[model samples]
Target: MTWSLIAKDVDGSIGVIVASKFFACGAVVPYVDAETAVATQAFCNPLWGTEGRLRLSVGEASTGVLTDFVRRDRGQAIRQAHMMDKYGEFAAHTGSECIDWAGHLLGVKHSVAGNMLAGPDVIEATSAAYLAGADLPFAARLIGAMQAGEAAGGDKRGRQAAGLVIHRGQPHAWLDLRVDDHADPLNELSRLWDVAQERFVHFANAMPDRARFSGTPTRHQIDEEIAMAEARRKAEGRGSRSHAVEFG
Candidate 1:
């Protein structure tokens, strides 16, 4: 019912993941800890969704967390999860009893996992696309990877919910977009990402942070940042549409 991936940026300062599944509200499948840059996914086990993130957020190692998860969960046979820690360690688990086409691919700083998929090609396409988009923006790279997976036959049951989460140097999400239910959730998620770049990102950049707890950029300053973002997008040959944009 799901396909997902977690990855760190080339510089290792940013982490993003995309998850899409056949269930409603499946967009919330990923748990990210920005402070440690740890991203964890728990598809078939609800406990790992919270407990796993808590462990990683509190400085536990990915292997240790995953080990404990497997130890404590009696239903491991149907579970699936993957983790990426701050040190670029990658780990993944796909239960033997999971549906056909269920498996995972772990890379140096990234991991892709899926269950109830069309075929193993889904993971292959996603991994290849992720590496190919190494130079794109972090969030864009994740979306592109998911796009490739969808092209290769995503969830066998079809899309219903999709999500993208990204975090940088702060404990809060730099970008978090979700499609709770949509005919084409991935494209909807991409559209929301573009909308975020138009304003939310500029606003987020000005929010108080560890280095500047009392700092808040003025409206004029935020406007400048927005314009700069738009300029950068245009320079990259991306369209400059303030609204009414569509994602294919």
Candidate 2:
């Protein structure tokens, strides 16, 4: 059994996450580029990933490309996946051959996951949440999708674990974060998402203009300050410590 999904934000960032009964679910299913993201699930044929991404790279509409690919695929054994480009275009597919309770959905900025959830309502709920459109980042959107799915009776098999990933301009890795191996995967994913926002701030602040301590100090002056501090610390019999600085 396999499950996978991917999404991109409005800011040209990419994220991909997936969970499968298969070990290392994250490794074989998700793919991302600077401009696009992809996921493949069910029998988890990784081929759809590169092929669909190639379509996106060539300027094909995500929905159309995905639809055609799924249609032509001879083996649709419960596959589910999502794709998005830097332009905010997106698409998703959930095969009819998926597990009895499996389904998928598409919405404004994201796509719903597919698998053995409570019922078809799982897809509806996730789709509704996406259409609701929260101001949160891509990670939150993913968690929201999971939450909706759970509320709608997610994983008739019962939840075992979850994960999340997001790509933001700076500090927010183009695709970073994970919360695998949990009893409450969606909630764990949310917790990781919040922590990721803090990372985003740290990354934002680490930019060239803000890397140094606040306030203007010429390069020479800053070097002098550093040297003076070292001298003073040494004179005060402080322990030997090296100092290093980066501009950006």
Candidate 3:
């Protein structure tokens, strides 16, 4: 019912994108932190979102985490998941009982997995788009990759919702957007990404960080930062993450 791409960038950013015929696909399917990324779908066990993340955070290897999850789950044959560690180690599981065309693929720093998809092209195009757009901002790369998957015929049933999450420094999400119900969730997500750069992304930048106990750089300070950041982006033809917004 869903497909997702989980990746960790060289800069220690972790991102996840999920699309599905199911409602609120993002809320349950993808999990990410500054250190690890995971997608759990195909008869998803929600516990993996929390448990798997916790396991990885505590220093468990991706392979070991997958092994532990599989050993404890009785319905492993119907479940699907893939994960990547901060060190770029990857692991995945695709159940035999899952729908046909359900599988996964791994790349330099990413993994693409889905079940109930239209065909192998869905993931193939997704993986290709992601690697091809290595120069894009983290959020752009993820959304564009998923869009390619959609163009290649995404969820076999249809599309209803989508989600993208990125984790950079803090324990909390660096960026998170979800389209719980929408006719074209992917485009809506792209629109939201555009909206985020307007103020939300810069606002998030002002929040308390590793050094500041109480988020400094108050209201007006944030406003100036936003304006200045935009000016800088315009000056250099850059956008998110100091790079131009170029989608594949």
**In terms of TM-score, which candidate is strongest?**
3
User: Could you tell which candidate, 1 or 2, scores higher by lDDT?
Assistant: 1
TM-score of model 1 (CA atoms): 0.87
Q: List the pairs of residues colliding in candidate 1.
A: none
- What are the lDDT figures for the candidates, one per model? 0.76, 0.61, 0.88
Model 3 bad stretches (over 4 Å): 228-248
lDDT of 3 by residue, 132-229 (tens): 98899889998999999999999999989999999886678989999999999999899889878877888787788777768755698888877986
Clashing pairs in 3: none
Q: Which candidate is the best by lDDT?
A: 3
Tens digits of lDDT, candidate 1, 1-248: 68888887766545545555655444456777663433334346656767776767677787888888888888887888888755667777787788878899988768898888999999999999999997888888898898999999988877788877777777777777878878898888888878788779889878887889865856889888889888888899988444565689
TM-score per prediction, in order, is 0.87, 0.67, 0.90
lDDT minimum window of 10 residues, candidate 1: 35-44
**What CA root-mean-square deviation does each model show from the true structure?**
3.9, 9.7, 5.5
| Regions of model 2 farther than 4 Å from truth | 1-23, 85-87, 169-175, 198-201, 204-248
Please report, as a residue range, the 10-residue window in candidate 2 with the lowest summed lDDT: 201-210
Error of 2 at 187 (Å): 2.2
Better of 1 and 3 by lDDT: 3
